[model samples]
Target: MGNEYRIALAGNPNTGKSTLFNALTGLRQHTGNWAGKTVSLAQGSVEYKNKTFQFIDLPGTYSLFSNSKDEEVARNYIVFEKPDVTLVVLDATSLERNFNLALQVLEMTKNVIICINLIDIAEKQGIEIKERLLTNRLGVPVIKISARNKIGFPLLLDTIDRIVTGAIECQPLVLQYPDEIEEKIRQIEPHVRAIVGDHVSARWVALRLLDGDESLLDEINRLITLKGAS
Candidate 1:
């Protein structure tokens, strides 16, 4: 792939994430499942501004912390692979409902771009999203788009290019847990940083540990080993 940057498309089901993926990649796409799992993974490549951007359409799920196999695949790929940018697709009509996953993803990675899909439907329903408010609240770039009609994609591409090229800087919002839990996280943070060494966010690792997500813990340890080897 010659140093292609990987962009992961993540969102709830029926948010039109697949449509955007197809539009961006065109014909250079492939479909398959994650190894040893039935959860499907779709990938494609697109060239923009002299750089190749690879897109991975993760299986749609309500939450990454869920027990579904699809959630497992999406969560692991993001945590382990650590894509260059995580494109979080949100439903404009139901921003509150879709914002849950976006918030979860923000806890994991800093490089995030939120795409508000289904703007046409939202407008028809008289629901309008304040892109600037959301962008400021999340501390990430939010692009309004109607993927089915291919509206606002040019600006989306430009934003992606700028982010990947370091022209745009992103500092994602951080979520604060309860005081007791925050105390525990502070204690565990040092240990996690010692092992992972910034390969991933230490606070995220601490949260996962507190949540008792053993599968993700195993994946994190494996990634730590690979990073150490490299």
Candidate 2:
């Protein structure tokens, strides 16, 4: 058996996320419910360059704010499970809209790769994406591909391999909020860090708290209680 890595596949609905997942996993995948949650996620494993990559297809969500059960499940997995790397798929034709989710994922974790799918279609529509510019702006590797045609799969898999093996480093873009919000985040982040102690992203927890995310607060409290019991 080769070394194994867990990758969380996330994107908005109809971004060809499932198509990419199917392409990578082929018939070696299974669908199951997340622990204690009714939301089901498809999981599969594939071997690349003598390494095993296990991909978990998270529910398609526009935002990570736990507005719905599916969103909650996806957010919790990324925050708590801390996959080795998150591969966020985006529709090349609708790059602007797809960026909402991609940016959210970047805020949560630095280990991320942006996969722009359907590039061929986008080109046909005369939509041009400057890949290098995007990489510079996002501070992460961005690969263009057409999942349906299996175009650029080699580069995609190679990039994933590099990230998982630490051959490539990612410094995800961090958004700057209004001064008032920044001040609040600064105030609460230390307290959150004290409690979570690097178990999760304290800054993100602080943001959620400021947004009055009751679901996240409950989750934090539950984790604290579990830690105390342990």
Candidate 3:
């Protein structure tokens, strides 16, 4: 992996995600924070048809549940950093929970690519994921890739370029949670601008806070303190 570019790979934990990431960037991986959150971020670069692709490997977590450190890390990057593009890598075998994270990411931002990995296992288990149906549902370019075999690398790279260049639009399906939670998110959305910006969806941040993320609370409290001083 040798190129000058930036990307972020996000997904739930234990999804063969790290293996796929290594396949994409190879020896060029590096680690750091996501600008504000102490949550660690890993990045690597690969030369894709004369274009350099840099990728940020996010901590794998189940859904965007803000109760843990990894969720906050990936959520903040998609919501605040608004990276050039976000790859929601999912384990094809576990669509239910894996998709839960993907759907959340979509709600927070527009640039997302779906990587359905481990199709081999899914087929072995007699599970068929109607790819076309899934694609139609996602409203974005979906790539069925076996990172181990490198089956769909070219398509993935091309899709990445399109998303980053704004040629392709990634739309999130607005999923309704429990009415009580939705009410809370609606209430909290307006209070986040002091800490984030217009580039992010306030409702997503509000949901995270409602789920009780310590790091997010810390950030909001810090902002409140600063605002009081000013």
Q: For this target, which candidate reaches the highest lDDT against the unseen true structure?
A: 2
Backbone steric clashes in candidate 3, count = 4
The positional error of residue 35 in candidate 3, measured at the CA in angstroms, is 4.1
Model 1 lDDT tens row, 1-230 = 55579899999999999999998888999986666556668999988888888899998999999478789888887876789899999999888999999999999888899999999999999987889998898889999999999999888888888888889899999998899999999999999899888777889889988999898877776766766799
lDDT digits (tens) for residues 3-118 of candidate 2: 99988999999999999999989999999777766777899998987899989999899989999988998899999889989999999998889999999899899889999999
TM-score, prediction 2: 0.96
Give the TM-scores of the predictions, in the order they appear: 0.92, 0.96, 0.82
Q: What lDDT would each prediction earn against the true structure?
A: 0.88, 0.91, 0.77
Q: Higher lDDT: candidate 1 or 3? A: 1
Q: Which stretches of candidate 3 lie over 4 Å from their true place?
A: 1-5, 33-40, 178-195, 212-214, 221-230
Best by TM-score: 2
> Model 2: which ten-residue window has the lowest total lDDT?
32-41
Off by over 4 Å in 1: 1-3, 32-40, 224-230
Clashing pairs in 2: none
lDDT string, candidate 3, 1-230, tens digits: 33345777888777877888899888888887666455667788877668788788888888665666667667666665667788888888888878878888788787778889887888789988787677778787678888788777888998888776668777766778999988877777777754565756777777776777778667556755865799
Report residue 209 deviation for candidate 2 (angstroms).
Answer: 0.9
Question: What is model 1's C-alpha RMSD?
Answer: 2.1
